[model samples]
Target chain A: MNKVITINLGGNAYQLEEGGYDALRSYLDAAGRRLEGNPDRDEIIADIERAIADKVRGVLGANKTVVLAREVAAIIAEMGPVEDTADADTAAGTPESTPAAAPGTAGAKIPPRRLYKIREGAMVSGVCNGLAAYFRVDVTLVRLVFAFVTFFYGTGLLVYIILAIVIPSAETTEEKAAAQGTPAATAQEFIRRARAGYYEGMRTFGDRKAHREWRRRFKDEMRDWSRDFRQEMHQHANRWWQQGGPTWTPRSGAWFALPFLSLFLGLIAILGLWVGYTLITSGTVIGLPLPASMPVWVAILFLIVVIQAIRWPFKAMRRSYYCGGYGPPCCGPLGFLWHLCVWAAVIWFIYWLTQGGHSATLHDLAQHLPGKLHHALSSLKQWWEQL
Target chain B: MSVNEKFSSLRKGLLEFLVLKVIAGDKVYAADILQELSGTEFATQEGTLYPLLSKLRREELVDYEWKESEAGPPRKYYRLTAKGREQLQETLDYWQKINATLKNLGLKSRP
Candidate 1:
């Protein structure tokens, strides 16, 4: 027969059957472990307790004493499963194997768990430490990568802001454990590695009610993971783009000169041959060709100067310093070389076109003007120079 | 002399001197205090102890400070106040009377 007893909980006295007390004790022990990181633990526990009490009152109102364990178990099943401490206890380390509170000896009170903002940070969601608990990676690596991403494409920073908002902060002992990568902590990153842990079987006790809650959390994790994964992919692609479009990539300081360099090099090659060929063709624009009779070897030398002399040297310099990642250059010399080459090409092309034999294009504009008009323009230029 | 006589006396008979005795020896955080109690088989739900200590604080019997931790947030440590020491003195005196009364009846061992 079940015996009557009044056990004190916290400061409140609870009158329950002997059988009920044992069940409550075991259930609470299990529930405490599960409720570690969950924010709504107290509310959930209170609700479950009230439900159990109501069930007990209903049964005992008719029968004065001697309630069965079956009655309480039935009620608990409707609330949620009891923690499966068998395996969890091994992982819990200290709390499980330790004895429950002893009588007469003073209990040292534990302060409530608190969440402080992390320090020594880079742009990693301020939540990377939190994420590391989930993923089990070195904090340093996360920080390093985070720095690089923020340095380039600072716009990508909004992703971290989104994460800090979307991801729940750890604020309790259980949450801290999870945030630190302890087994059984519900850290989403940790849960991801467990493979088998996704649903990890129906909870041991509180079968019906717990199932509903479990399903909800599972769905939430899926959505959050998908969003996080997508963000990660985007960052990776942006990094690859910054490396180079093809041979000799561009950089910010030197990147702006790329278009001008191409134009300069093309103009130099055209002018070199055209002017040399113009000199060969009696200074008329007779489809300028390389001055072949002037010695093919010198022409070859001239071609080298045309392409490689100014621009190629700078191209080599730009090639040397071309490091990627907007965070900061780790001293990439090729990048500097490429920039120099571009400048050389543009400068040399402009220099040759003016000083080298006149191009038909420049001469044509001169010829198009009427003789009288041309004389008047020359005189106007002289007048302005004198002033 | 009815139920309260039995239950109240039962509650009162268990001297709360343990409370003073616990705090008298050393400074402690609430968690350590609970842990010490558990070792002695005195079970406590965190819910119960926090309120008890909060009352102690309110009465100016105890004081606490927030201390930082490397891995986590700051912790609060409790120390006895001057008023707390006076309360302890009064409790000791009251205990002496109960022991004296029992002694007058020619009962008990060490007073």
Candidate 2:
């Protein structure tokens, strides 16, 4: 007689005879632990079982009728560990936690469950907040615990790794509750292979009534997981507006900060230059050329000084304008292109209105740079491109 | 007996089979399971029993239905699945091989 193994897939039962119960259980346990914390944990676990099922029908090469432990172990070993962090981060950061609630019905709490706003900064449905509710602690405390662990003994890192393997990423509040269970200790290479989804996966296998409840909740959670990526972005953007910088540009938009600073300094410098140059050139009969008739290099230096004075404030406060992984200040190559188009349009509009054009002096700026300065500018441009 | 000796005598792999075997006949309750295992070589530990029983229930070898108890509010009654009965037969066959070897070595009697 051969003992058969049955695994739950989407509330459906799948049976395998060759590998038997132990083989199936071990595969589920190992694969489940590996996929602990990922957002799509359920899907990954389901896929792993599907993969196992696909390979489970055949007997060993010898006279064996049932699948052996070694074959099951080999299959799991071949699957490798489930990786939580993936290419999804570049586009979505993480899959959105469960489906959305009705617009007017936001912030309603689920019964027998704690709920709170998650880290709108980087999270799947304020994962931290929901966790805080379950732990009966402050959200900051939960975050701090994770942060401290991640920082010190890599406890947080291991937890994250296990979570990526075991804990499903929170999409809806219901799923977040599930991730809080199970204090993951080890990879337990053997036990996992012994117990599939039906055994150790449940909170307590004593009763089946709660499972029926979990199944119903799980359907809602799946709906939550299948939401639009753009809506998630909108939710994130909404989060920003609620607690972040105001959208309206201030009257003193630094719009005139640089221009004013430059004007003030430039006027002072011009006045000083006029008075000093006039004094030196007018009074002194000779002394290496007149002050007012200073060298072209001196004029070039003055222009450089004016540009720096104007640009300094903008450069200093540039960090304040960072738009969350947005490329760079509006002066990079792309920004330059955008500015060119906008400027051309504005110029054309002005040309249409006034029908006139004027030109400034040939700013032979780049030509006047010292060799070292030229190298610095080139490096800066390269750094901008890398960004 | 030392706790480990007591646990070993009761645990001995066959206990899982016995639990499944006993439950296979009827949808028995938790107290009923405790009473049945008591009559056999298997001695159930308080701390470990509930969790292990739960694990067994999850494996689908045992299925349970809730019945309101006269003494308490409600209690869960468990029974074996057809799959569980098949599993019990398989375990018994595996046990027979080991049990026969033990008896031949004069290290065991009828269990």
Candidate 3:
């Protein structure tokens, strides 16, 4: 007794023998490949399927509900090989033939190449094997290159992991054929690839099961750890609040802002010292378009004031946070009025520096500064020569 | 190429023109068109016919309407458009001209 498989074709259900199903599936796959790049590929395939359904229905009886392999083979033969239909399409001067048949029939034995990760004969995630296939190189050579690069900071391993995630594995026979640059356009090639896939699946079955079990265990451990950590944090926060540890008071808000203000001032002082050193060494400022008349300390002070103006709202936000996160109303209108005045002053200063008569003075400094530096360097060279 | 290959290619080229002629006759289902060509040298399978019909439709030379069928689901009944008739007339005229030229050449070469 042969095993039967049920399939839906053209919205009708039919039972097919296992062998018959395989043959039909491969035949349809070949047809689909043959019609690749055609605009109406799906519609034509649907029509072909409906025709196959009609033919199969004609052969079925009340008692003989299951389609046998020989009947399927006969039907495929009547429908003709996909190659013949492609030939007819090309001969008929259909525009689609240029793209679909160009690689297959234009004296090129290879199909259009696409990069796909191969699962068969893969050592680790199949990335190297896929790369070797794509570039038509030996797998050992590709692996050796990856190994050599991995010694330099392990970037090669990182790249391999990324590629494993990015490139799709060739799971189906058709995809495998496409990956190898030889699309299976005949039943023999399809069956060969399908058998190879079956063997690969069998070989990897045990490893796959172990990997799945390990992943499940890891996920369970992670979930339990996170739950415990969250509970501990919750209990600690509750105890601290219950002890009345300075919650949501103006004094506490001042205490929080003090540290940030000191840190900001320290950072600005370090930056100012660095800019002063660069200016002395280079005899000119690097990025800043400051006029030579303007003092470095004046520029630094202006920067500090501008940054403080921007940080005003953030300071208010910290105060609100100490007030139990109730937002701006907790701080009241005085803080908002102070922020508006600071922002208006900062904007007017920036506009004066960029657009007011100061810009022309800055431009004159930019043009003359380079020439002045050149003259000084020449005079220093003359003095060294005399010595 | 071999003689058989050349002849088959020529027949394939003419297949589309013949399909246009068939659709011009009446609004017909795909199976009906297949049946009409079954006995002729241009006989083709549904696998070949469907794509060809689709191309013809895409070119705006033919169109189809869904019609209910008794045996199964609704079928697409195909008919030629106005442009298809104009194209068919030009093709026919070109064919006659070629035929006349071939006949004249044949009579002169016989001497």
Highest TM-score: which candidate? 3
Query: Docking quality tier of candidate 3?
Result: incorrect
Query: Model 1: per-residue lDDT, tens digit, A110-183?
Result: 22333322322322234766655456677667655654564443323434444565777665434454455443
Prediction 2 global C-alpha lDDT: 0.46
Candidate 3 ranges with C-alpha deviation above 4 Å: A1-8, A14-42, A58-77, A80-89, A92-109, A121-124, A135-156, A171-174, A192-387, B1-3, B24-27, B59-61, B68-72, B81-111
Q: Which ten residues in a row have the lowest lDDT in candidate 2 chain B?
A: B43-52
| Clashing residue pairs in candidate 3 (N, C-alpha, C atoms within 3 angstroms) | none
Cα error, residue B65 of model 2, in Å, equals 2.4
Candidate 3 Cα deviation (angstroms), residue A12: 2.8
The CA lDDT at A171 in model 3 is: 76
Estimated TM-score per prediction? 0.23, 0.23, 0.49
Taking the tens digit of each residue's C-alpha lDDT, what string does model 3 give over A223-291?
754565466567667777897865655655567675786577557546644554454334344565678
Model 3, residue A291: displacement in angstroms?
50
Give candidate 2 misplaced runs (Cα > 4 Å).
Answer: A1-387, B1-12, B35-41, B45-59, B69-74, B89-111
Instruction: Name the lDDT value of residue A287 in candidate 2.
Output: 34
Deviation of model 3 at A259, angstroms: 28
User: What is the iRMS for every candidate structure?
Assistant: 17.1, 19.7, 5.7
